[model samples]
Target: MVKEIERAGLPVVHICTVVPISLTVGANRIVPAIAIPYPLGNPELPREEEKALRRRLVEKALRALETPVDGQHVFED
Candidate 1:
């Protein structure tokens, strides 16, 4: 639905582990997620570390949303 949202003149940032799929779906702004099962957090990590990771991911996503893109763009660390 990223394309659909953009079609309506709204920007969307797709956060997913699969970058290719996000591109195929026509997501203009993409953020690489940590993992498939835990896209936003790592349960194997300590609570604080996981939180920090999640925060950074979210910040990147927000940055992606704010940035302008002519086509599919993947925001990577």
Candidate 2:
């Protein structure tokens, strides 16, 4: 579905915590975070940790858009 959407000329952004999954799925525009389950935060961690994780993830996402790729690509942290 993602590739289909992109192929239609509408850009797609995949915000992923798990880099491997996004790579296997062939995501051209990708953002990577800390983990697979939460993508941004871990409830077991301190509040500061969670906040910092979220901020970093979002920043990576913004950067993913600026990157240009010839084909499917995966952005990493």
lDDT of 1 by residue, 2-75 (tens): 89999999999999999899999899999999899999999999999999999999999999988888988999
* lDDT for each residue of candidate 2 in 1-77, tens digit (9 for 90 to 100): 76788889877778877767777877788876657788778888899988987888787777877777788777765
- In angstroms, give how far residue 69 of model 1 lies from its true place: 0.9
* Candidate 1, superposed: residue stretches over 4 Å from native: none
Clashing pairs in 2: none
Scored by TM-score, the top model is: 1
State model 2's lDDT: 0.77
- What is the TM-score (0 to 1) of candidate 2? 0.73
